[model samples]
Target: MDADLPPLTEALVQDVIYAWCSSAKHEITVPNCGAVWGPEADVVSVTRARLGHEFEIKVSRSDWLSELRQIRGDRRCAKWYRAHTLTNAKEEAKKTAGLAAKGSNCCGLVPPSYFWLVTAPGIVRDDELPAYAGLMEVVPYRHGIHQAHGYRVTETRPAPRLHRVKLLDNQLMAMARGVTLRYWQQRRKAA
Candidate 1:
């Protein structure tokens, strides 16, 4: 690392992602919600049940490997689909449940939903990444000195499903709490 260079921070990567996604019209405005769900992911943005995206920030290869281990080990993330049991569809629900409960890599859900790996620009090329992974590049500058912008996303997968994520436990509560807390906090500050 050069003395003039700045270390890439997770926050910077996330900020750029937030801006980029919003600019591109993604429904998820918040970042890092998936962290509380299972293993602490860098960012997981969900737009109701229609779409979901996961962002993994990696400043270095080691950082990338480490965070990946957490997700890999967290068996809870293996299942992202749910069973839909509508009236007159008991048989379908049963079958969906059976498939959902199946082991990982079961095609339980339609994928290509962008799992973004935001890293230092040019750190990892797009061709080098997994087919399912979309790459977002960031450049970190000194705190409050250099701003992160012009981020690029390449080879991104579009995640579309009736159920983007299956609520594992109280993750929904946490998200709600975050929304309420932020609302009040901002209101109080303005008040």
Candidate 2:
């Protein structure tokens, strides 16, 4: 873990969620939106299907309200306005509804299917999240990643029912290759 990084528990929770999404073959987008709009908007938007309902993933430890307060601060609040500029709450609600509709149609799910606030253990109490909503609690698990000289390397682990998906920085390079191949394949087919 980097010295400047937030607590290991927090990062671990995020990694677990990332792994879950990866293993499920869902397209994960960071800095998404959720039910609650930030001063900026949402962070970590994950959309899988084309025109599918999207999820806004928020990570918190303790003090969710306090965290929300910080989010309303100048720097963080700027993100919401920067991402969404509809001029009024009505417009924002309309856009949110539209996004939810698209997401539901794409994924064959219903409206307001938001996977909001996956936090570390004990971060959010049962009463914190809404009863009838799609809020989820993601518990963190251990993965064999040894830190050496400011870098971490993942080691082999026992194959469990749910295998953790390991995504390294190099994964982006592989994505580029896949995109290039797809383009050429499509071009050849068309030709």
Candidate 3:
């Protein structure tokens, strides 16, 4: 019944993210771009030239804080950051409040060439992001009988080619799974 429509959830945030990626310029976007048991971001895009983009979508404050805390407390994430850095990953290694950006850095896996924070419109302040990171807003609405999706790019930049190729290769080998499972994988991988 129409009255029983699902409530807005992180799934919606992921859907909005996927839509944005599909329409994004000159990049191939994939949702759940990690293995069935790996840390995955809500969205990952790879440019034709092989640049990697990572996006974190927070539908709730809890989700946002959880991501932040994971970045700050996870030793394995720090280890991955160190490992990727030795390979000369393209992204910069920033130390934010003693938490390394690359240790975020994926919060668990390899950091993308570019990392972005996306949230529902009016949810975050631009000043909260690192200078290199971008912020985006996703707004979904229903117009009478038709539903349309829209997004606002408050700030953004291009992805990195070499890193993107690596992301695509990694996702290709990942076992297919549902979004919920993949999301939990990210949480678990962070710990």
Candidate 4:
């Protein structure tokens, strides 16, 4: 986690994600997830789970891959997903194909059942959009709310697609500090 990130940015990311998850009809659980098995293996600042599904929250491409490398080799980390029934070998194979179709920039984080890329305006350039398309749904952050546009992943894709959304600077920083944005999004809907 980047210690330099602004405190307010971290708060916004956490608040938005929490709100989003809480509003979901399903019984969603945000776990203390991290990546520690791959080459870039490092602690994922914030991760979440719902119905045995897990997702990693990333604000940038570098952060996303760093966490992914950690889980690539460490069976203990990989086992966490299996023990929780979050994913499997068969599903992993399928996710790779799905990500290729979407042109995702992420380094394949066990094929997310759901992936969210929350960024600030002007942060994600136009050319970068196509690279991540279909890979994960984009979640845009604006004002103080985060909304789901539609389902980006499907049986054809299987893996959680990336969602790109613009978030405030404070929110972005909060995510860097390990805040859960799903919770914030859910809270907004409940209100």
The global C-alpha lDDT for each of the candidates, from Candidate 1 onward, is 0.50, 0.37, 0.50, 0.37
By how many angstroms RMSD does model 3 differ from the true structure?
9.9
Going through the candidates in order, what is the number of backbone clashes in each?
Answer: 1, 13, 7, 57
Candidate 4: where is the Cα deviation over 4 Å? 1-8, 35-110, 130-191
lDDT of 4 by residue, 16-115 (tens): 4445555543243333433311222111222333112333335565664554454343556643443232334335535544664577665243433343
Please estimate how well model 2 matches the true structure, expressed as its whole-model Cα lDDT.
0.37
Candidate with best TM-score: 3
Give a tens-digit lDDT track for model 3, residues 1-191. Answer: 13344444556656666555655563666675564214655676655655566676776667766655554454667424533442354442222212433333333233456667777565555554444456766544434211223332334433233243243333433423444566798899999
The TM-score between candidate 4 and the true structure equals: 0.34
Please give the lDDT score at residue 137 for candidate 2.
47
TM-score of each: 0.52, 0.37, 0.54, 0.34
Which 10 residues in a row give candidate 1 its minimum summed lDDT? 79-88
Tens digit of per-residue lDDT, candidate 1, span 36-92:
334345675655453446677777877665545544453444322211111112343
Error of 3 at 27 (Å): 5.0
The predicted structure with the larger TM-score, 1 or 3, is 3
Task: State the TM-score for model 2.
Answer: 0.37
